[model samples]
Target: YFFRDPERRPPDLPGAVVAPADGKIIDLSLVEAGPVHDSAARKVSIFMSPFNVHVNRIPVEGVVKALRYSPGKFAAAFQSKASLDNERQYVDFAGPYGRVGCVQIAGWLARRIVCHLRVGQAVHPGERYGMIRFGSRLDLYLPPECDIRVKLNDRVRAGETIVGVLHETK
Candidate 1:
């Protein structure tokens, strides 16, 4: 099947950022935010196994400001350095309170990354927007003001688990 139905709906929490893909939370760290985000941000990387769902969902309600695809080497998604060298797609969303970024990284076992949304498109929290065939990795980038809720080695379900929460800026 190309997509699997979600067993549960996304939670209705204020400023909640949901997981984009169902997988194990492989890494969590503070990384230098790319051009799509500010100076520094919290990075949550998820490693999707073949048994996990491949479909991806929107992390928050927002407009897609930018979508970029970077082609690179196919490396193991669990490796920290793989984020920089792996083939990936970067999606930036402008939420009501803040901006967030999601990167779909191609792992050594994943051959394709499919994204359905485009620039300037409106999306909602937990909305299914894309998927990666087979196994892959998804990285959620949160602004400095947001708080991450998931930890390394945590198992997260796409669209159902709250990965982080955005805090309003003064």
Candidate 2:
């Protein structure tokens, strides 16, 4: 149940950003320009309950530019601080329109983060790349130009929900 089936389908809309994990959207905010990416970006935090699927999916089709692992505290995933203090894996993908970043965060009940993609690897939207063993959070950092589709408390399905859309900039 922590992996994807061959028949599973993601949305077909162009430039759509899909949810990386199944859960309720706990937070949505604009992060100040930081080390994760050069420009300020929007963050979508999804809290995966014990009953939700633990598998993680790719938010867009792109080349994996980097995969970073950070060891930190096991705070509750739903808290805003958990995005910075919790043990996590950061995956950066260079999509056609812009860059997309996904962070797999370990919650209080989660002990491990499993990411299967490597730097330079090409991945498709909604493709299973890794998973957190149990309850956890998945944070998606989107480009500043993208329009967010989900709001706080919205329920989302991994690989099936359109969480945002990347608008083309000239």
Candidate 3:
């Protein structure tokens, strides 16, 4: 029962950006420059302990635009740099608001990362789209206008937690 796929309630907050995995929020910061589609962006990192649910969900409603898997070293996922140094897959989506994406980073004990999403497919918030074995992490990258709702060290449930809100001011 480690890979539980609990039925998650759809977020009631307008323009909600839900958590992509069940775990503790490890990092919440604005990326000034990085390889996540653009330069300035808001990022939310969730660390999935071996005991937490492993199923991953889409964070927002959009059309999948890109999917890139990078094979890298096995590192402790709690480190901030693990995002770039660890084996990971980047899944990005294009919607009315802007580009939103998530990364599935493999943990030290993680050997396989499974992503059920394909490029050009339509995705929705809280929808199960991928998974990773053992301890792992999920990082949500949002447009700068997206207001993050979750905080560092906060525990979040995939598909049910409102990690951020995408503003439609553009």
Q: What is the TM-score of each candidate against the true structure?
A: 0.94, 0.94, 0.95
TM-score of 1: 0.94
lDDT for 35 (candidate 3): 50
**Each candidate: RMSD:** 1.5, 1.8, 1.3
Question: Model 1: runs farther than 4 Å from truth?
Answer: 1-3
Per-residue CA lDDT of candidate 1, range 1-170, in tens?
54565655999998999999999998888877753676898888999998888999999988999999999999888888778999999999997768888999998899799999989999988888989999789988888778789888999999999999887655
lDDT at residue 78 of model 3 (Cα atoms): 87
**lDDT for predicted candidate 1 compared with the true structure:** 0.88
Cα RMSD for predicted model 3 = 1.3
Which 10-residue span in candidate 1 carries the lowest summed lDDT?
1-10
Candidate 3 residue-wise lDDT at 153: 90
Q: Per-residue alpha-carbon lDDT of model 3 for 1-170, expressed as tens digits?
A: 86677888768766888899999998888888545556798888999999998999888888999899999988888888889999999998888768887999998888689998888999888889989987699888888878788888999999999988887646
Candidate 2 residue lDDT tens string, 1-170:
54333434899999999999999999898988533578798888999988788889999978999889999999999998999999999998887768889999999998789999989998998899988988699999998778899999999998999999996545
The C-alpha stretches of model 2 lying farther than 4 A from their native spots are 1-7
